[model samples]
Target: MDARERLAELVQEKGGSLAGLSRMLGRNPSYLQQYITKHSPRKLEEDDRRKLASYFGVAEAELGAPKEKSYDANQEWVDVPRLAVDASAGPGAANSAESPFDSFRFSRKWLREQGLEPGQLSAIRVVGDSMEPLLREGDDLLVDKSDRPFRDGIFVVRLDENLLVKRLTSQGGGRFSLLSQNLSYPPIAVSAEDIELVGRVVWKSGRL
Candidate 1:
């Protein structure tokens, strides 16, 4: 299709709106709409084109240049669903049973090196500071739902309808202590029957 059509497709692929992109680019909300739908400017200006391309992680040619090739054709990608729930690191957060709102694609080879299967993985945002210094608020975690055996590691647990992310330490007598990185919050003792292991937190991503 044409350049404008390609731009529209890229915005949709990124799960963003034209208005949002316009605002992100410091233009009026109608700027992208006018360019794509009205074609008032006929084509994107060089600077504007470069900005859009950079924001969308695409080549400038993909935005409008003729006889240009797309960059993703030869790339390997694996789509990981990002769930709408938050795994609280402190008290707890309400878990949402809804499906994913969006997804992120990672390199297939890289994921394999982590020994994780894309189908068995899901992502959730972390909330609270109990697990601070390692997992901060608003951090995203990749959980391995299949790894529910529960050894001594970080996990997402459901306790009394609240979802939590905490480090689990095995205690004798069929009990475990939910520990937090921050020393202010005391560890909580829980029986095996009192908590349900949701998944193991295999990876985390957020600001350093």
Candidate 2:
């Protein structure tokens, strides 16, 4: 795709508004909107393009800047988007906007070791104590968006409009229970068709 398309995708992926991003760039709130929709400036200014590339953690050329003949051969880290899922370990509305709030870098080797691809991964925060001890509140979790098969493990799922993070135990048939690590929280029996599996929780990190 072209620069405008790529920019639009990034903005949408982050669940952000053009006005907000324009403000961040110290431009008028309508700057991006007009630029994208109306083609006011025709092409992104160098400074604006640079800021946008930095903000999105992408190469400048991806947005609209001229590409170079060579890239850094020593680059070892790749960024994984941290989405604002605010997913609670218990039953809660995943109704909040799903967008990239920030990014964290991991070594390419480390990601490969975990069988994770940066394009298929996102990070989310635990919001409740339902899965305490094992998954504490305030923990940052790395979600593998590609692991959607039924498995007996923790997963981030969407039921109707609600988003949830819990463990799934297959029940022979196409059924499973949303299990909580903490016994205080009872299990929720659900059919596979009722819930939209978001992805599986693959890695977690947080304070002790």
Candidate 3:
């Protein structure tokens, strides 16, 4: 297909409108529409094309370039939605709306090795220094919504309408202690009825 057709297909796949793509690219609202419908500029500029391709998580070749493979064909990908809210590692952060802002693709093979199901997984950002050393600020945690059995490990819990990421230690008798990696922060003890288990933290990723 032609560049216009390819661009239109990608925009639709991303659930983005031409006007929205135009604004994201710092162009007039009508810029993308005109380019897609009419032959005004004939094609997208190199920079605009690269930006749009990256935003849609697709190679430039797929968005109307020569028919060359830009990505590995043997690699399988699964898209995981990234929630907009932060699972605070220190003080609890209120997360009234659990909406997703973006998505990240992971290799299916790697996910299988980790025994992670893509459908039941979500990515949330960590916002505090309580779980430092292991999980630093700005770390992205992969949570398993299906694995909420209250085991003795790290988990994302909701208490008093706020979300927190803490290490759970089962003290028995429906009681547990939330431990933090940082010693300066004190552990919190709570009964089963007091806190709600959001999900278990299965994996984490952050910059070095």
User: lDDT: which is higher, 1 or 3?
Assistant: 3
**Clashing pairs in model 1?**
none
Could you give the C-alpha RMSD of every candidate to the true structure, in order shown?
10.3, 5.4, 8.6
lDDT against the true structure, each candidate? 0.78, 0.77, 0.78
* Candidate 2 segments whose C-alpha is farther than 4 A from its true place: 1-64, 69-74, 147-149
Per-residue lDDT for 54-156 in model 2, tens only? 5565777777777772222234777676776677877675564555657787787887788866556778889888888889888999888664345678888
Q: Model 1 over residues 115-203: C-alpha lDDT tens digits?
A: 86554677899999999999999999988866435579999999999999999889989999999999999999999999988788988
Model 2: which residue pairs collide? 14-100, 94-163
- Per-residue lDDT of candidate 3, residues 18-130 (tens digit): 88567656677899889977877777777676556545546667655444534322348866668778999998899755545676788878877987655467789999999
Off by over 4 Å in 1: 1-75
Worst 10 residues of 1 by lDDT: 66-75
lDDT of 3 at 106: 85
List where candidate 3 sits over 4 angstroms from the true fold: 1-75
What's the distance in Å from true for residue 165, model 2? Answer: 1.0
Q: Candidate 3 overall Cα lDDT vs. reference?
A: 0.78
* lDDT winner between candidates 1 and 2: 1
